[model samples]
Target: MDELKVKKSPLERAKMTLSVLALIIIAACSKVEGQADLQKRQGEETPIQVVSTIGMITDVVREVGGDEVDVNGLMGPGVDPHLYKASQGDVGKLDKADIIFYGGLHLEGKMTEIFKKLERQKRTIAVSKNINPKLLRSGKDAGGSEYDPHIWFNVKHWVSATETIRDTLSEYDPEHAEKYRQNADHYIRQLNELNAEVKERIKEIPESGRVLVTAHDAFGYFGDAYGIKVMGLQGISTASEYGSKDVSKLRDYLVENKIKAVFVESSIPTKSMEAVIAGAAEKGHTVKIGGELYSDSLGEPGSDADTYVKMVRHNVNTIVEALK
Candidate 1:
């Protein structure tokens, strides 16, 4: 009896040790709350919850917020922002978000109304509003609410918005203020380089060929930044269908101005532009489909043009090469 009761076999002890190790591994993998401990085991902590209305805004948020934000873009590649409808899942995501970011001044159409309502209840922001309204190039006069919403087509403008985003985050979480500021500065430098590169690239096009025609009115901001005159088959939003009057007016402009190209949008159907091209041809002027532009959504994830900077660069390069 004093001999410690016949000890377990060596194989049995080994099995017990293996079982305990398996349990530990399983626990580590499931550690949603024990984030730090899980990180020690090769998983990182999801430190923050950020919900953005679109893909481009996610890029900026992640750039500025760094590891502090777990960002989600509700609208992905090829989503039409003007006609976007948020799903139940998206609503849940927005509701749970610590901070919600949206491209504003009605880029999201009626979704902007919902975001405006949410501002009364929780944390949310319109990233585009950070740009000075004075800098905006509106299709209409800017006495009040008619300014363009796509300021991000201009890198300098986007950098300003990034600063606003950082400042907003700093206000919310002062402890990580410096981190957000530093991250914003890093991204801003990239945007600045992109701006210069865009200007130089556009110079490659012949001076007389700078006309830009597109399916949506998104490029007023870009045209203003780069000195191109833009006209859209549709209004400032995809929500507005092209009327016969709109098409007829565009045909007259194309023929009168001798504009040689019209571009299609990545997210929109080409039927409208086809009608424009056909109508313009009837007017004794033919237009080609210039490159497809990333107007509403960015490119699919791993491409050179997926990030906002690269997206803008790709667009500028395509526009320059085509127009040139």
Candidate 2:
């Protein structure tokens, strides 16, 4: 009987060990299934695909899309989207794009007509065109081609457009509506904080010393944002001719204001800016060339100011340091 009891004890111990092993295997199998389901769900959900014209919109879509969508911008960093002419590759990109996002309000100068046709089909909206007329550059007609399209200069304007973007993304991807909302919320917060920071930095320089002279008139909205008078040798679009008239006008602004510094833009030709500086110095104003500012486009890859947030921050810091 004692031998039988010892044998039974060994058998019971063996049974218990097997039971634990079975539980572990069962649990692992359940976890594996769960992970598989996750992957399957992700695969089942079709991602919203977009083709954007400009860097700012591309940056916004990337921030909002995260992993749920794929976005490609036709214009790369420092490539002026305003003057971009569609290539065969661009046409192919447009064809494959489930939704096309182009900065409306004449931003993509030659591409406006292409986007307008899509708008009639309810496939596109003028993202920046919806901003209040007052906030845009003065004298720019509200509904006319004369309007300046650089609404991204004002963060408040950009935030408003972000809501439009959020709505558009939600309409197309109803299942991911909540996700888009959260992303837009986060991005808008960043923009708000950025706007405040820019305002604060601009305030460091007194009003009398507040003139911002640059290579182009891209900063009209920026000047309107911070109450600084701005003058540029060229027009809003870098494609505009930097005529001798524009250069002389910029030189005059620097000399008349006694402004100590002028700025060069990343996308525009700096030689004209150098001329402005030289002309100012000829008048004994001694204007220094400020650091490069991202105007028409953000910086190149791996740059400190590559992203929209960093671009605005870098511009503000450089402007403040130069003027102050």
Candidate 3:
């Protein structure tokens, strides 16, 4: 017996064609992805992936590693490293990073535990490790850190940090060791120039007018390096609260010293400094808010204070102009 022939509808024919095209596209994509993966595994010369907790560390890594590193800073402009916590997305980034760098010395107070755990699995370095503990300032509060973590404020110390970055990168990527050393040497020279400029600019301020008061004590290193007296409404960490007594004491000190201005940090709340100002005003002293200073973080992209050197220059200029 002969079977009857069946005619397919136009819609059915089109659907079948579309299904075949989809399968073909999927197969092609899979093949491409597999090939890419194979290439990656075949000793491809990709940039060394790095994740730095703060922009200053990121800037140094980029300057030293140059084209050899692909770096991402976890914290950006105006971020308070003392209180910044890593999100799930940040953890993902950390997982993929070949190396991680942080300010350390409890500067990254919240992420300290996370970094400690990450250190076991990957190369995690604290740039501040190279700093001499003797050079670090002692914390003022009863229950504060023994050593201050704001070493970057001292340009000379940061130059040492650049050496640590160079050695770490060279050890991890020996293939380009000479390149890393050369880059670091160049960057160190730039930092030296920055230090000289800072000293010269600071000289513009009168001896008695060199007091730098801010919302927090982030500039202890700055004060020590540049011969300025630094005061803050809060302690070494922003986590420290100020009592009315603390405010009154600072108010009396500012009035006695005839301080012209008090500065607010970019990452810290203005209320603390405002309270200090009010207290000083009540004591019959006129204190102005000096321009905002980039403390824990750098300024936004395209701003004059975006880079480390620029940030320092901007701060010095602001301090000198306000006080002079």
Candidate 4:
């Protein structure tokens, strides 16, 4: 006897088709989720691009932003920000940056127009702009703005600038705001300690020998905060011309006061200070060239004054060792 063959019911076939469709939908959803996860990972891996005008600002951003930012400084070691002009390469860097930080009050006088133009297109900031006006020293640069931009010399003022950088970074990347705050707090504490250290070190110099004579007036804030008298051959900006009369005046002051050492600036030519030393020698006063101080720029990489903190410590050490 032969067995009878039977066809499957339509409902049973429909049920099998729906089961296959459901599997495809689930697989598709999983693929989409994997792609989303990859994108999120990629976003987290990318750092915020930053362009800073000077080394001090660059160091602060690095300290505060930590691993979250990639900073490129336009003016490197031994570069004068007051006279620094933006190159084509620098413009490209600025254009590509997510944020730009500069020392305001005409620190980068030649590049002011570039920063102004960039402000319209990006988050351009002047780190010194937010500092208390009362803390600022009046500028004597006839061709420059009305205030000195060397706020970093005073560690306390720099603490304010650090806070500004932290706030700006936090505003831009809210996910890393807490990280920035923590980093800033740590940095500020270090600065406070540094401030105290500087005060104590400065006191080691005899009260009469506490005068700091440098190539220019860049150390005004430093002298003010540390209770040292400051004199310079030229005005606040290196752009100011120091003529024979100015040199004579400084030379006479050194000879009259029996000052032993005057510092040459890293960013400035040593010829002017050398001239003053020579003039003093001619008048029977022995004056020596003190160690070079990092002014308007940081020291080269691997040098003692390369970073901001190191720069401050190096300057104080050099000054005290020479004058005390």
Number of the top candidate by TM-score? 3
* Model 3 lDDT, residue 239, Cα: 81
| Model 3 per-residue lDDT tens digits across residues 1-324 | 889989999999999999999999999999999999998867688899999988889999999999999999999998888888889999999999999999888888879889999999999999989788888888755224777888999999999899999999999999999999999999999999999999998999989889999988889899999999998888888888789998998899999988979999999989988998898899899998998999999999999988898899999999999987
lDDT of 1 by residue, 102-159 (tens): 9888888778888988998788888876676778766453221377777788788888
lDDT of 4: 0.92
Name the top lDDT candidate.
Answer: 4
Clashing residue pairs in all predictions, respectively, total 0, 0, 0, 0
* Per-model RMSD to reference: 9.9, 14.9, 6.5, 11.4
- After TM-score superposition, the amount by which residue 143's alpha carbon in candidate 3 deviates from its true location, in angstroms, is 5.3
Candidate 3 stretches with Cα past 4 Å from truth are 1-39, 140-143
| Tens digit of per-residue lDDT, candidate 4, span 1-324 | 889878779998999999999999999999999999999978767799999988999999999999999999989899988877788999899999999999988898878888898899999999987898987998954334689888999999999999999999999999999999999999999999999999999989999999899988899899899999999898888777779999999999999999999999999999999999999999999999889999888899999988999999999999999988
TM-scores, in order shown? 0.82, 0.82, 0.87, 0.86
Report residue 112 deviation for candidate 3 (angstroms): 0.9
Greater TM-score among 2 and 3 belongs to: 3
In model 1, state the lDDT of residue 237: 72
How are the candidates ranked when ordered by lDDT, highest leading? 4, 3, 1, 2
Between which residue pairs do clashes occur in model 4? Answer: none
- Candidate 4 is scored at a TM of 0.86
Candidate 2 at 35: error in angstroms? 28
- Winner on lDDT between 2 and 4 is 4
